[model samples]
Target: MPIYQAPVRDTLFVLNEVLGYERYTNLPGFSDASGDVLEAILAEGARLAENVILPTNRVGDMEGCVRHDDGSVTTPKGFKEAYRQYCEGGWMGLAAPVEHGGQGLPYAVHTAVAEYMVSANLALLMYPGLTQGAIAAILTHGTDEQKTAFVPKMVEGVWTGTMNLTEPHCGTDLGLLRTKAVPNGDGTYKISGQKIFISAGEHDMADNIVHLVLARIEGAPEGVKGISLFIVPKLKLDAAGNPGERNTLSCGSIEEKMGIHGNSTCVMNYDEAEGALLGEPNGGLRAMFTMMNEARLGVGLQGLSQSEVAYQNAVAYAKDRLQGRSLTGVKAPEKKADPIIVHPDIRRSLMTMRAFNEAGRAFTLWTALKSDVAHRSGDDSDRQAADDHMSLMTPIVKGVLTDKGFEHAVMAQQVFGGHGYIEEHGMSQFVRDARIAMIYEGANGIQALDLVGRKLGANGGRAVQAFFKEVGEFCEENRADEKMAPYTKALKKGLNDLQAATMWLMQNGMKNPDNAGAASTDFLHLFGLVALGYMWAQMAKTAQGKLADGANGSTSFYDNKLVTGRYFMERVMPETAAHLARLSSGAETMMALPAEAF
Candidate 1:
């Protein structure tokens, strides 16, 4: 059984002390999000996650989602009721607009709330997570009527949301997708296509499922230029504004996968389904990105949440398990053996997981805070800078977090040795579950390509440069802090390395386009590690200040933050050195291999 306590207190430290949620709350559209309100909301969410959602996870996994012969899908037992609890508690609409029945909280607070659920039950939480993004897209790009019709239900959790991007033949390459939406005379379009790997695609968790689909408009253009987004409801709407007639969209079947089986990953069939355009015709990819940005961040949280949960279990197990005498000689000779924590190797594995999980949390919260600035800042220039920074960081957040998150999970499992691999120990589930995050939401490799080939140069390289400038300011301001010296040094070194790599790539890629594709992955990870280290430093400074003021009491939390920050600086941050070195190696090193090299 995976027992997950919401790291509520720790989350508060990150939000209130580290990120200064107080100032963030003062941002436009978030005036009501005071520190008290944020804490109260997170506390309520923590209780629900611990008492309601967490308990259902093992049950959901063991039961999984059922694919009925009649073409319906059934989520594991207790999910529907739990989802109802989530909705009734206003969980789904944490960051949605107040007019749409949402609480209109700051995205940073919601990020903390979601951390609890995802850590407790990611498979189950995906139901509402996707819904939140769907609601965001419709609200941002949909016609006024679409918002009036769709936003309320999604916010109320009466209907769930699904993203329809991947097809049988396409994942990241939208240009290759063949799904089409033919305009009909009566205003509604006819969407005809098959979309695969749709999470929460077909489930009984809600009264309806709203799919924000991408398809080609007839004769619009070839490739991605022709792609457009549509709003396709599983249940056709009635005149009374209720779900009535059956829509042409149907689930052909659901997928059986290695993990996340609690939610149905389905093959959807849209046979001339009546659909409405989300935005201007032939402008769907741009519209779909409204949803993608949110989904990408949510997916990044999945990585952070799972790694945290896995770390908790591994630490508990390490402190309890008795093992052979430590190499330094056992202190527990009177007892049968020393607890595993006495062993240096076990400590290394457990500490590695902790280092990544803590840094990941800080990085994610910082990203969420940036998202808050991007959406709510009143100053146009400030908002644009925030958005640019966000655009630059999204792929790193999604790619590096998921990639490293899986590593932490596996490393945590290694703490349990054989027990981690065995099903009875409940450790393997974390590894199995975290695996898909890397492949989905645009595969990590693809995310790297997007970071290097596109976002880095968006608006003429200003976004990437502005990002470094902000980090430089943070480092310069805190360079003299007693506990922050190493952090400043590590962060500055990492930033300089990333900048050198960026400059070298631009100078080299001009002559060889192939160089960008070959080095993107390493470069992306290098950038991600540096960003995480920057965040870890921020966390350490905050924790140390709190301890100086006698705020943390006798707990090890503050000391642990300092240790983990140092560990990350020493171990994980060095990864960038290797990656940057590899970036200088020509693409031919990888491309030169024969097709049948094996």
Candidate 2:
């Protein structure tokens, strides 16, 4: 089994020190999220994660989910018990509104707990993870009756939820979706569709599954405009508002996927299942995007979660293994060989992991803070600015985090040599699990196109312009501080590179759209590098302040943070230049070859 200790210390640093979570206590739900309260909650959450859920990770993978003959699925052993505890702890409703039987905490607190849960076991986490998204959708867009009927139980964990999209023929192109919804002469509709790749689609842990489904109405307009959203439950609700009769839906089969074996990724069959209109008819895509955007952020966290765990185990192995003698000479002359940690190449790998993991953690928490403000702040202008920031950064968060996250997993696995390849060491599982994030929740390619084609120009580029202005201000303010010089210099350079790439895209992509498409991926990455660099620079500033204050007993922790930030600035920030160069290369070379040339 692999070890996974939640990075609680680093998490707290980001929450209190880097992001100034305390300043937002005046926000609606953040009043109770005091530092001491959050710290205690995090301690308990870590206990649940590290001690309970993590032990089940390898077992779940080995046993997998079993499908029975009755069109039902049973999760691997221990999942049911774990889920019971998860619900009992009120985790599902931690960030939900108080009127719905929830803690009413800020989303940032939930984000921290989510990081722990995902790091411990991503597959187990999905069951509740998807439920949160469904709950948010209902809370945001559902009718008041729908909220009264569904929100409490889902929050309390009696029933779980799933998002049903993507048929066999369609994935991202929801306009081509084929699911059908026929009117039943009442407010209800009879839905008939087969949805594939539905995570937690069928599971025995929860009493009923609430599926927020997308379907086309019988005489509706064609394409995406025709689609409507429906609340299709696996079991119908009774007069008492509990799960009553079984709905006409079943798990056709479970996917034998490469990873997340613990989660029941099912092919769901809804044979004229009774459902109610969720939002307005022909308004599904707009509603669905609310859930999709929330899911995309959660998926971005999944990237960081996998990286944190993989890096932990890799560091452990690097210290224990004794395969190499250091070039600095016989420091371990008494033994056959020195520990592999002594080697420069191994140090490089470890440092790379450390730098990215910390920077990524900061980036995630920063975005999460923005979410808190966007949703909870009273000022309309403040909310708008935060929302714009989130819209611009969503694709970068989804695309860059997953792409680099998987790469980090592979690099960590390499630290274990041949042992990493074997399942016993558990590194291969990390690699496998991280692989799916890049492909799902809108593939990286689509995310890039979204960043370039839509988000860049959204609100007349107000979001991107806001981002540029913010970074420029930070650099200008901190440039003169002697200790902050290195970080600020690197951040300024990366910011310039990002700005140049944006200009090139705007200039060339106008005449030839393929030019934008060709540069999209590289542009997204360049943007991501600058974002992470900005995080590192901010963290460096925070660490410097702490050291200057001589706060309590913390010398090493603050000092080490400065060192890690320095590593990122000097070693990793330069990748922005490479990405900028690629973005400037345009589409001519890429499109020159004929379609059949391959």
Candidate 3:
């Protein structure tokens, strides 16, 4: 009734059938997670999403987190209970390694599960999502004592986590941060600074809150490199790893944002906070990157998930909302009026959202699988390759997904006509909720610059070339498929466009650094479109084979894939051309304005 189905079948297609994630179980550390185990995990995750979490979404938006004068925050009613159920269910550490008391499942499985959780409730999902990233960073770079003290607690969901990188004066520009970490006598540090736009900064859902703070050492270098990361807890740990004294960190205020009201975006003040160092001294920026990288992918998942939910509801509404007769005569003539879905344009928008949502899922899984491979594989080359792929795709995952993802949400809202503007219909909330994802986690513009200016040339372009080479492999294999001739050809064209765009950015940026900043956003989108097109083609090929097998009346399942693939090729894939043209036009327009220009 809520237009929210598990999408379980499609998730399985991506997990077991297409990506073959079960092979990870063979890895020494991932022994606990196999096909049957992951399947069960997904099943339970779906049950929780549909039953436990979906019920709270509307209420969460209506009654967001309440901030109090006592510096404590209370979540909306039922949020605490729902989070308890989630923690008790072990969903918090779905992909964490077993050594840390996590479930040790493949990230591929967790990604599919994440789609469900977010579609059910994006706001509530942010709590654990941010926590998971924080714990991951601590585990990777934190001292042994820190890990022993904090890892199990977070992995068990007793406490939560937040990333503190933004400030009122600086957000994406970390170089401007004035947060200070002065060395103390006890080998600890005293952190005093202001951090803004921190999600889950102050909440009542968990016992203790672990904040990974990015601040500068007093005499450190001026920009990003000068900063260091520290682990500041809401409740200071005692000798046995439990919340003891209150840490000096407190919320200065919470941000009033356009959307995601349930998520507390805090303006935190770390006033002489006794904080333990996470890694090496003056290595805060590097340590903070661990959290940022994880957060970036998570933000992308948020985008894709919003698109999926919006598309689902829009499709349901279109099929049910009746207005007028069809131009091609009415199939539902006896029903007083034809369903809105009968109109070509309405179907166009629905298919647009549906196709993009489906392919976006595949792309996300593909990206997550790369992360899994990087972590699981024993070979150094394979590990590095997977890491390289993950790094290269992170920007696309964040920038392109959120940008197009917002478009998909808006398009879905349009399908509802006037009703979408009204909040009771639950459509406007999707739009509002998804908009912030584009702004946070390095901002979509910053992601684009990182992709174009940094990752494109990282390792001397080996990463970029390796990815293009993989696309070439996919294209070569698909050229022989009868169903993929057109798809393959279109994919090839998009690939050429991407390669040319990449080369142009690389050559031009070497001449003028500012040019990279100007052209980054367009080039990122161009890269995303081309990459997604290839993903869809591969998905179509796989779906076609599965459909030909005629397993369990999956006709509609794979039939929709072919139809949606066609829609994307015709409508969506053509978007790269415009972006490519924009990239070629040069960055003069972006940098032309003088300072303080009206």
| Model 3 steric clash pairs | 228-284, 229-284
For model 3, how does the per-residue alpha-carbon lDDT over 1-598 read when each residue is reduced to its tens digit? 3557778878878767666766666664455656676678788999999898888888888898888998888888788888899999988988887788888777877888988999888999999999999988998898888998998899899999999988888887889999999999888889998888889999998889999999888899999878888989999998878899999889867677788888888889999998888888778778888888888898999999999988999988988999999999977967999999999999889887887788888899989888988988888998999999999999899998898778888999999999999986899889999998898888888898889878998999989899899888899977887788768888888898889888887788878887778788888988888778987887888778887788468788788788888888888888888888888778788788898995
lDDT of 2 by residue, 514-583 (tens): 9999999999999998999999999999998999899568899999998988988988999999999887
Clashes of each: 2, 0, 2
How do the predictions measure up, each by TM-score? 0.97, 0.99, 0.97
The local distance difference test score of model 3 is 0.86
lDDT score of residue 315 within candidate 3: 87
Tens-digit lDDT track of model 1 for 1-598? 7677888887878877788877765685566767677778888999999999988888877889888888898889899889999999988988888998888878887898999999989999999999998998898898889999999989999999999999999888899999988889988899999999999999998898899999998888988888989999999888877998989989898888888879899999999999999988888888888888899998999998889899899989988889888888877878999899988888788778788877788888888888889888888997898898889999999998898779889988898889999988777888988999998888889899999999988999998888788889999999888678878788889988999899989988778988998889999999998888888878877877878888547448888788888988887788778988999896977888888995
Give per-residue lDDT, candidate 2, residue 363.
Answer: 91
Go through the candidates in order and give each one's C-alpha lDDT. Answer: 0.87, 0.92, 0.86
lDDT winner, 2 or 3: 2
Model 2 alpha-carbon miss at residue 115, Å: 0.5
TM-score, cand. 1 = 0.97
Q: 261, model 2: CA deviation in Å? A: 0.2
Query: Of the candidates numbered 1 and 2, which has the greater TM-score value?
Result: 2
